[model samples]
Target chain A: MSARPAAIATLLDLPKPYLLFLGDTREPGYAKTAFGLRDWAPELCIGEFALTEDTVSTGLKRLSPAAAYAQGARAVVIGVANYGGVILPSWLDSLVEALASGLDIISGMHSPLSSVPALREAADRHGRRLIDVRKPPASIPVATGARRTGRRLLTVGTDCALGKKYTALSLTREFAARGVDAEFRATGQTGILIAGRGIPMDAVVADFEAGAAELLSPDAAADHWDIIEGQGSLFHPAFAAVSLGLLHGSQPDIVVVCHQPGRTTMSGLPDYPVPSLEDTIDMTLRLGRRTNPSIRCAGISLNTAHLDEAERRQAFDIAERSLGLPAADPMRPGAALDALVDSCLRAN
Target chain B: MSARPAAIATLLDLPKPYLLFLGDTREPGYAKTAFGLRDWAPELCIGEFALTEDTVSTGLKRLSPAAAYAQGARAVVIGVANYGGVILPSWLDSLVEALASGLDIISGMHSPLSSVPALREAADRHGRRLIDVRKPPASIPVATGARRTGRRLLTVGTDCALGKKYTALSLTREFAARGVDAEFRATGQTGILIAGRGIPMDAVVADFEAGAAELLSPDAAADHWDIIEGQGSLFHPAFAAVSLGLLHGSQPDIVVVCHQPGRTTMSGLPDYPVPSLEDTIDMTLRLGRRTNPSIRCAGISLNTAHLDEAERRQAFDIAERSLGLPAADPMRPGAALDALVDSCLRAN
Candidate 1:
């Protein structure tokens, strides 16, 4: 628990007033980091930048690195995650230009920004920093399984990139709005950038996954809530271990099962189908009980962005009826989101 | 599957005919590496060396580094896993002495053999290799969960360091003796050291645990059996994620449940009690079915070293009667071990 503050402090030391770089990604799904910062931490994001005219925008005013630097942007955050998480060769020029413009480079890519020779050299010559958010902190201890004093709510998914982070961020805001002591605990890169601190769950060594999770949400006041953003689904073939380790380490008193209704297959893994919401809740509780025996499902959070207004309501109704839990799209704040938040904060 | 040969080739390139270094450890448990090599690959071992006069011995003839090198030992293997897997400062002189004696150093510790300045400088000066078995291979893919050609058996545990590796090794040997095309798949450092190749499961990135497991036991002939070593307990708060990922990735047709009969708590976490054999088998099969729908428990392998002969027999009888699974201590090499191996090989 003592390690939590130090880790958080180090993670939060990233240069602020960022100019989000969307690269050439046309799909909004690829620009999750930019969108996340815009939606969650708009004050910290000065503007958006991109190489191509056809690229999707975060709706912020577009600015060049030099322009953004003049406008108080301290860094250029790589806001798009592409396949393989590699930095494209085509994007190197813009990155080096940013370094030369007196703005630091920040990236959440699988490959480090410093790994690109041009970016590293320009940063070195310009005395700018290249921060890779995916690199986990050194010296995480193994999970102790000793119960912490706080209440935790974890957002688990039925697949990857389907709103686990959104649900967590929404819930933390809702809880805080209601006067509960709540903090958003990030576990992935996008969420880390938005929250200003977190352990990159997937980047850590397998042995320390749970330990890192434990460190992320250390003991707090009994009434405080740590809304932990989850990574991967329990049924996801490739990433379930990350999900399970996070679940066990967080030892959440309440869990919000997040799912995308129209997702036929697990993300990036077409061979495996997405698990049913019922099965997800059942399995999460069963496995999560290994650490927190009294763990219970608080509600269901749906990524109903694909559905029409009528269809969203219908889906929510069906989920609430079948699962006997409040269901809502946290992205669409309303009575449904309120009900879901209320369900989470309710005493067992 | 393409990565398996290359990984194995790289891992098996370590120098052989080793002198086992037991350091100053008095506990036999800490000397597991020395004993594992002695038990599994006796011919590869030249002799054992220890710093203290009254330290527990592997019963191999005591020899100094120079003397073992004279007898054709090419390397000095650090054969003890201490509290932190560290190359202790007190043992630095001996490690440097080994390098000066013209033997390469192989270590399976958490801390790399090359991390110690003296060891690194001495190895460099002597032009000898310093191999660290705990470091995982680079470029592991995310797991696909696609069924492969080979039949596989994985030995899972109720706790860490309770004989999962030994059980898998024993079963492989028995299967080989019976003319089955079986290979021991190592997942931990000691197992890697014994089998000459393995993915250090705990040392891998959390996201790649399952992928590494998949790589470890790749598609083989339909008749081939890859007896995969397991890591950690599914009920273990700290490491269940590793166990789960390995279980899902291994996708074993048959599973052997490994346990220590008299153990009350988890290996290091005393707050949690050991899971029951029935619970371990049930949970393993249930979650393992995600990747492997037809996964089934084969039998039980017990670490009965602490129990007397009478207690061991009674415990085996009770477990078999209660769970309807064959139970045996694989280290004992008798009728019970035969029964357990037979159960594992039987058609599921």
Candidate 2:
């Protein structure tokens, strides 16, 4: 056979580069890549260049639907910006034309390309792989205080600032203390375009019941069990919807509700921190049972710093009675938390 | 008071009418702008018709430069074809020029302006705010799953795959079950660049630990915890490293370690899902302790699909004897899981 068909020939006979990189200087991710270049793929041949009308046009010129096949670069991953907020057609056409030229194209957009019709069209095309980088939080190991795979935190929040970072940090530290590793996955943000992505609604509900089982189950790391929190509650409908949807899919080990008892005027919720203990527990319990009747809840991690000594105590006790867990706050000494968690494990 | 200085903007300021509405388009955000039609602060505005070929003739244009703001609009938000990658200068410059007349500009890039010197220089000279959306997963909320959010998954191994939509979907489901509304923050195909921004050497290891924490943590929605994976153990080190670093900054609660025991390999440890008994508890304790040492662990979720009945039972027995908790494979019957978890919780 005289080398078979070109596409077939290349498919059968080709030694592609183990590494090649293309990035744009238009975003933070561009430099972010530079930080860990040696780690992502040390051996791959990488190329970093500015993307301009000239550069993009030039990059496209450099590729050939057929030639790329010959030279052996089968994939092209295009990174786009998110804060910019919208995807423009003219901007995408330049890349899409080249994508048509035969390379396996992976388009990475930081936001949902709901506004960009060109993007949607190109994505609809065959042989084109469109990946929204904004679909999930990149998961990895980290430590709040100690070390070991301590805690796996699903970072959630009402708006961008409910001390999501703080809560995640506190929990990680707690888990680390017990010699467990923690992985943080940021789930929701205020700006739906930037932080939130729609996942199936049905799947989210299932994870709730799973959460209870996880808490009651034995942990492989330390002697006790665990906890998980979504970013929002029913109070914050959009994110709560997403959080709920996710539960349906994950079937989490157990579910825990974290929120300041007070309310906040912004984002259309009660004050960020509820002033009353009874309200907090009532809300937590009410929200906890939405997914599964079997789903058990780990007591709240009273964000005590936000409240005074009395309010904190009241909140702790209230949450304890409502959720059937021990009184615990992250910032305080761990003995109580340990005891509370231990008892819960034992009692279950 | 020179109009109190136009609250300069970028593409985000573009009027809804200029946008050629297509298949499914809605600026839920734009609809909610507090500023009236003169809604044009001029700082942020994105428009292709506004920026001509002349904008690209020069090097880079300042979309919302303090010195040169948009002509008519006082404020605007920059837009970029910043899908998963960065934007071209031709496009960026055009966006920059959209803002003129001395309005406070916000430099929006696919990554961070700091990623490249040119963008930084523009931001510095123009007194524009540089927002790094890539490093910090954007906090935008949008319902785009099903028809809203599309699916594209490529498993380049574990670390890379963790950034996939499926993982986010699982997280969303987990949260939903808890009735803690959560949304998917689609960072979309986070490459080594944004994903590995500040990772340390032990990133890969962190991811593995994270997996375990998710499984073991009693809290179904592991939003409180951060990372559960061990360092230096992920399929992609950058993902592990950056994930941990990001979480370190964000600070999560606890971590769960998902252990896979097999042949001795990468970390000089046996595979977690191995056939032997000690493989379960021994590997978990080591992994958990190494990742973090503060937070508590829930339990382990066994990947029993890889093991035969006897092997699974032996593994389960080992876990029970060693860790004193229930075991589960994400694939087990619900009753089996509930009964096991119930017993484990009651076993105090």
Candidate 3:
């Protein structure tokens, strides 16, 4: 029999030096992954490029999928925008070319790349690996209302993509720097790829969404904080179920409200305006108590990226005064990292 | 070749006179399924009984699952309580016996009978059918936050089994008696079995829980009201996700809050006290606006079954006075049914 390739345990450990593929997809999710890895985990992401007939800047350089391996890339992380409908028949050949070149392939979409017969055959022929991060794992137990004994910090957002993952990471980093035993539990594909393991909360069946969270933040030693990445906003009509489920499942003792100062309306729904930061904090605290009665709004993870230096300072000041919480961009220096960490530690 | 059986388009049109199976499992879910049918659609329920070696009363009479067809039972509806574990080996034998006797099988448990090899084989051998009511249908589209035009009424509750189902059914009956085209849309197994078709909201995956509601209450004529049954209480630690999901998914114009006067605390979590009627209404109205901004809490459905006649009347008086909404035991005449109808019609 021919030699068999070892099963890849975690994408984080995958021979990265990753070729980020943003193929003609301008969805914020794709852009975020490209920019997030480039900014935060640049050491893992070797090159940023896309393979598409349409010559768009994509804010990244262009490289054919066939040329990925030659460009010092060990794996290709495909961040295509469209998860709905059929995968373009046109993209398969390029993918097959990449597989033939011995590049491991990864995707974070509803359509399983492994389900495509030709793609599967191509990977099998070249002894390469294909990972679909959105495929929910088997035998996830139904969430029992077991009161976990560790302190948990969950980063909830005003809407999707308001820097929940980023805030969670920042808090985890801060906690680690302070010599605290803290962990960042990822809930999305991008988080999973960067952090090595996490449940794709959206991909999980609704009934098990909470169960996934319960399992993700397994009981840690007391005083250790699990900074869990939260999903959608509770006010988002399209995705509030996931948001609420994550909130309840995490059973967090400390909730960090993540909001972008410039988000005037609910994402994608112009008719629905975003709730005021105060309203979000009030609602989140109330809802969070349904599970964890002691849950409190520890601080505000303000995303003021769209504002100028002066405007960001003003917005942060308003958030701190109006919401009566420490507000700051976790990524920037002189942010309210001290207040957030102290609040969590004090709660325990 | 052997002759093939005819396809079953809808169980609603199947020979009525269903045999209800309790199976020595006296879980609240089973008793509700049996009693719900006995009260609302008695014409369809030919018999109600249990089958078990334990010989417990199960609060219902005993019958052999093997003896189902002999009792003129066209179908055996299994509402066993233990859906958590591997279905007892004893259950499969009885289920197989029913299938062998040419009785169709219907179950509303997390542990699906269709997954049993012996039962499937028996059904195949006898040309009988197996129906798992909790099995979600295919291609349930993600909720788009699309505005659905039509009047919808949802009965929310302070806790599970606090008369949400009873309230919805009562309102539908009251509406029809008044010559309005109102429908009670079931979101659980008992309601589904009673009404013949509905989305089992709790069984649905977390992400698509709202989508199930959207599809269940399709846009009706402006005059028609789809009174949808609600699930778990928002304050329930074990199940708030389902409650919040249903609330958002239904996008109801009118909401009726259901409460049991005797419940001093939440169902399982004794530490978590049930909110007062006023607080429940306020929180519900606030959260409901996340989806439908114009949502109104039209009335309170009080379940005062544990109270004496005078106590129930007094409880209703207290609820109405405190909530400042029409409050009543919907089962009783001269309650708040007329006021609830007026609220929905007025909202329209």
Candidate 4:
């Protein structure tokens, strides 16, 4: 009864590993999810707040001012922290303002600068701190393990809560089961994931400015583009927002999309889908145009668990012949993608 | 800035579905997950206020009374209308005490009970008007479509948000694609989801007593057991609690569970997955034992898109061999089940 996560303490312990939720429901869901998180890590109360204007500014300030105030807190307001991301300056601006107003903001952005231009401006304007999400794309981290012996290619998911982490974890397990050199690299928020090798530690969102810079990378190290996966559907706004942010941020070489089954589709409204191979290729091309006109989308991939081998092959064929891009399975993305990444990595 | 949900409403209007949760964080993730239920239906602003002995009773009263007074004295406090099973009395006692303290009490239960023995006792002890939440399970009323025609099986997941609904929807789609008859029935909270059925009567949970009765036997023509799908996970106390209540209140033929994937891993602690298949079959069998020690579980089902085919086949095979029962895929439980239900209906 006494050991509780109080509002005051939670707020004071701001700037912890947190999540920036966009939709109102997702924010509350985080609260609901706290029980499980707490069970996993009692010290973790990962703060939950809506990513609305006032929440970003005032509510967050009241909830968790900053790590600076973590000591003076009367009670723990939240269990932990996690900053959700869209890789946009406008969004990061609000988060930074929240942080500037005293709430440490952190996230996994491909290219922080590419997404949020003003974040850098904000960090400079008011002495606000930033966190590096991860190192540059070309040098994606290689988890020290039976490392990929060859052109090690890794991928990640789009968001924090989405099944991306699990996807990466599973992919790693699957890879290990097959005596293949591989590792997992987390990327983006709930609906996004990135699994790669050789990413530097600094890339893990050192601060908001760096995250902003990484998100808005103009050249978007496509060569270093860490192949990322998404947690929610391809249609989730966070997915779209952050996915596009990664596109503009790293301009990935080959985008591998992971889709889990069991999504709601009551209305035609956003039942965000796991990216179809075709859809992934299409988005790659589309995003390539939007992020950089000169960049051509290399290829796409899908989870392929829901489909049978025949259906899975058909999906890949559709991606290859129709979409004119290579496709791979999440469990085991074959040689096609490896060759492409090699070609891209080797090309001038 | 004004677009923030909380900023727009004075915690009273709570433009979002704000649920001021007041309970122990250890109350199993079920109680907490109700907050996430707000996500599946995004129109509401869901808020949570975790509690202990202090807040669950007195502290909770303070918020509701204050909120009611501020908002012109209209308050709707929701809790398990009747926890029923073996642990029913004390819960009713606590609920009654809270109800007596002055404020409209909403019996937010999704079951039909014969009678709340404890409520009747508490009502006698302290005269109070009880309010019941009448919101229909949103899935009902709308025309979902026709059931897929199929002979294959479906494996229900462990709980909510994990992927049961997705499995249901996708399995239905998968069945249709393969020319099979399939439908998803989400039985929990709203009672049942007869997806795509012409008799599209949405699941609307009425009074616990009423809900119990209907669920036990929808009509004079109903039976003691019918193929049922329970939403949320077995671990979720609220769901488990309610399901237990319903099991005793109105036991169904067989209960199929649905669950989603965990957002993250429990870092230090070890997670022993319930062998997916074995745990589910055992649980279902245990449920059967309640009615009759001799009554055995017919089968087990799983609902997850994350596992690859190899994993799925392994999972299915495990269920068949260990559980020593057939696989039950909610997606396409064929005519045998239908015949059993028909026979039950005829007998009733």
Per-residue CA lDDT of candidate 1, range A1-348, in tens? 121234332233478889999989999988877887998989889999989899999999999999999999998898998777788888888888998899988888777777778887888899999888888888788889999988999999889988898899899989989999999998888888887778899988988888889989988998999999989988877788899999999999999999888889887777888889989999999989989999999999999988999999899989999989999998888999999988998896
- Lowest-scoring 10 consecutive residues by lDDT in candidate 3 chain A? A2-11
Residue A243 lDDT (model 2): 35
Q: What does candidate 1's lDDT look like per residue over B113-174, in tens digits?
A: 76677888888899999998888877788888888888999999989988888888889889
Q: Residue B232 lDDT in model 4? A: 30
lDDT of 2 by residue, A263-297 (tens): 44325433332224344334333333332223344
TM-score of each: 0.88, 0.29, 0.78, 0.25
The fnat scores of all predictions, in order, read: 0.66, 0.00, 0.38, 0.00
For model 1, name the residue pairs that clash. Answer: none
Candidate ranking (DockQ, best to worst): 1, 3, 2, 4
lDDT of 4 by residue, A117-234 (tens): 5666666666655543333333222111111112222233322233444444544444455554443344433211112122232222111111222332222232223223332222
Residue-level lDDT tens digits of model 3 in A1-348? 212234422212345667776656645654556676666566666665555455233345556555657777887877554545234566677778778876888877656777789988999999998887776666665666678977899999888888999999998888888899888888888887676567888767666667778888877888888999999898887677788878888999989989998788888878788878888888888888877889988888888777899998898789878777788888785646687667666743
Put the candidates in lDDT order, highest first. 1, 3, 4, 2
Greater-TM-score candidate between 2 and 3: 3
**Which candidate leads the pack in lDDT?**
1
Alpha carbon lDDT of each predicted model: 0.87, 0.34, 0.75, 0.35
lDDT (Cα, 0-100) at A1 in candidate 1 = 15
Candidate closest to the true structure, highest DockQ: 1
Candidate 3: which docking quality band?
Answer: acceptable
- Model 1 stretches astray by more than 4 angstroms: A1-13, A22-32, A49-73, A80-103, A125-127, B1-13, B21-32, B47-74, B80-103, B121-128
Evaluation by DockQ, superior candidate among 1 and 3: 1
Interface RMSD of each: 5.7, 19.0, 10.8, 24.6
What's the distance in Å from true for residue B170, model 2? Answer: 42
lDDT of candidate 4 over B290-316, digit per residue (tens): 322333333444543566657666756
